[model samples]
Target: MNIDTIAKMLFFATVRIENHGAKSASVGTGFIMTASLENGDQCPMLVTNKHVLAGAQQLVAHFIPRKPEANVPDLGQAVAVDLPPTMYVGHPDPTVDIAVMPLAPTLLLLANKLFIQALPLSLLATELPDLYTDAIEEITFVGYPNGHRDPMNFTPIARRGITATPLQLDFGGKPMFLVDGSVFGGSSGSPVFLFNQGTYRSGPNVITAGSRIALVGIIAQTMLRNAQLPVAEEVAATAHVKFAQELNIGIAFNAKAIKESIELMVSSAGQHLATAATGDGVTELSPA
Candidate 1:
């Protein structure tokens, strides 16, 4: 399989999150990003939805081991690192579904054995130039949907769709937008991107023939349809609910929310680096 440079990078950028709780086991998606500090230091963080990390007895992050001689992932050989509970940090606002966990200690353990692609904050589309001319733009997102991935290669799957809501405006008066894509239960925290190659719109009547890529947002929730029941006085006492139908639409928190979440984590008494051994003997970092 010949993967392009962009696809390969995106594949490596994502890490599978397995949440094992007392009742059941669930899966979700997360991507690596470099959070910049005021002191000019860059820290690699695992960005994902807060709900994905909630109620988990233990969290394991799956990563692809790198083949040093070939400078590529070993594919079949994967590594699982247990993440400590203290490592999780959520957005200051309880309502925000975004959270970030530091990866410095995890990277140290991986060392040269695993390959990771961390995107910098500069990629966040604080301002989408193309949005000025077009309200509906195509987007690409990478993740493990419904916990499905390459069984042999251990890589993330990429999906494409268009923006259902304008990127500049907050959807439903929140810092979010909608994507018309086949988002599933395990796609939370997937990074959304706006990728264009060849000719793209630059202005109202100007077209630029070049490539552009921007990190527009991150997947937070998938819209689902609940069947409406007939109103009855006894409905509240003996209500039986059916499974919600997938709407094929995903709600994503825009880049501004992501930035704000990072800032909130950083500003809270500064990020302290504390090293501790997990139950499985995996090294984890706890930020203050």
Candidate 2:
């Protein structure tokens, strides 16, 4: 597919995620991905940031009603599906901040009514030649900023930007990179895409890279600068300072991390399945 077509397809994989705490409610963005095994097995997973799910007693995923494509041109209502604890599978390392949840049950419920798509495992950097990540290119992400959606299509907003930092290099001592894009609270889990639009440089060599779309990383957090400089305790104790604005510097964990986490998920899923096959009522899935 062409770049535009591929972008539209990726949206089907991106969905609105809601994390409901016992007393408060919050929302974030996430996307879907598919992993294929050597044994000819394919697994569907839902991914998002770990912090987005923090303190959440319950989780709900919202999908745009597309498959049942509205008969009229006007916009329609969205479907909100509550997710059980057993439905989500998070990364073993709490520090990783990436979670994977099975999407089969969700797809079954939707009955193919939602026009969502899953990202192929081939789009992962770890699964591809190192040349892709070695090249610096433009990137984009779709997400709900401040819990806002299109309302018309019930889709998240698409934000485009370039890589402020190199993909293969670590940012601030972490396995992530800096993105020169505006990031908000609701964008915590947005997947960072590295889809080329035209010719770009590949390290010291130049190449005509076009229509190449791969998920290089996922937005983890954003950088913030103190709008009001902090004063010494002796000068102004308990001083109230002005709020800070988004630096538009986003932190995206390398997609390699996701690939590593997926391995853990595959193994755990096998064990979970074995237990389920025995009707043991044992499920080893939970949010980190």
Candidate 3:
């Protein structure tokens, strides 16, 4: 896709996710990813943080409908798909907060009813170009903050920040990095990207005049700091603690973790496909 199309497509790449529990409801973000299979099949999957769906009795994904004539989103014509919790498959490693859900079945049901622009797996940055340690690239993350989004347009809020830590090294001995931005509760599962158009530096003293984009990571946690509590004039026996203040730094799991999570889902589906092909106690399986 051209740079302008790609940039515009990024706006539709994410869906505002609402987690509904028996007693309460919460919100977060989720993005669609198109994973290519070895069998020449393309599977669309919804990617998000595991915690976003935790304790969710029903998950609702808000999607924009397509205008048949224009083949573009119909803005105000938004549709929501309420799904059971069983549809989500989380990372095998409990520590890995990534979760993925196959979108083929859902799309098949919705059929030409919705307009979704999925981010291709090619956008995942598995490796970085040669760069020195001093390089600090600009990053952009798309999501809803504080459960806020354009209710009429169904568009997410895009925020920009810089890498607070080196992408080459795992931050805090984990497969994650830090970003300096205004991250909030509902921003979890936001896809962090590196998008440079027109011109970019390929190496030291080298400027390349081309467009570049990559899915660098996914937001998981926001850093916080406890503030000192003030003493009461009455000097009560105990004082209630206030909520921690946001440090405006976000913790994002790197692209490799996302690739691994998608692979896990794909491999599981592939195994089922192989079994079905053999006609050996195999049942019809949907993409995982």
Which structure among the candidates has the greatest TM-score? 3
Could you say which candidate leads in lDDT?
A: 3
Model 3 per-residue lDDT tens digits across residues 67-171: 776567788768899866767778887987899888898888785877777877766776333322234779899998998888877788999999999877789
- Superposition TM-score, candidate 3 onto the true structure: 0.86
Runs in model 2 with CA error above 4 Å?
1-4, 68-75, 133-136, 229-242, 271-288
TM-score of each: 0.84, 0.81, 0.86
TM-score of 1: 0.84
For all candidates, the clash counts are 0, 1, 0
lDDT per model vs. reference: 0.78, 0.70, 0.79
* Pairs in clash, predicted candidate 2: 12-117
Candidate 2 residue-wise lDDT, 1-288, digit = tens: 122355556555677888888898988888888766655556777888877766778888887655344422123567787776455656776677887777776678674566556676666666555444453568888888888887766767888998888987877676788899888889888888766656544446656654466677888888887687566778777565567767988888888788766777777767221111111111111111
- The order by descending TM-score is 3, 1, 2
lDDT at residue 135 of model 3 (Cα atoms):
42
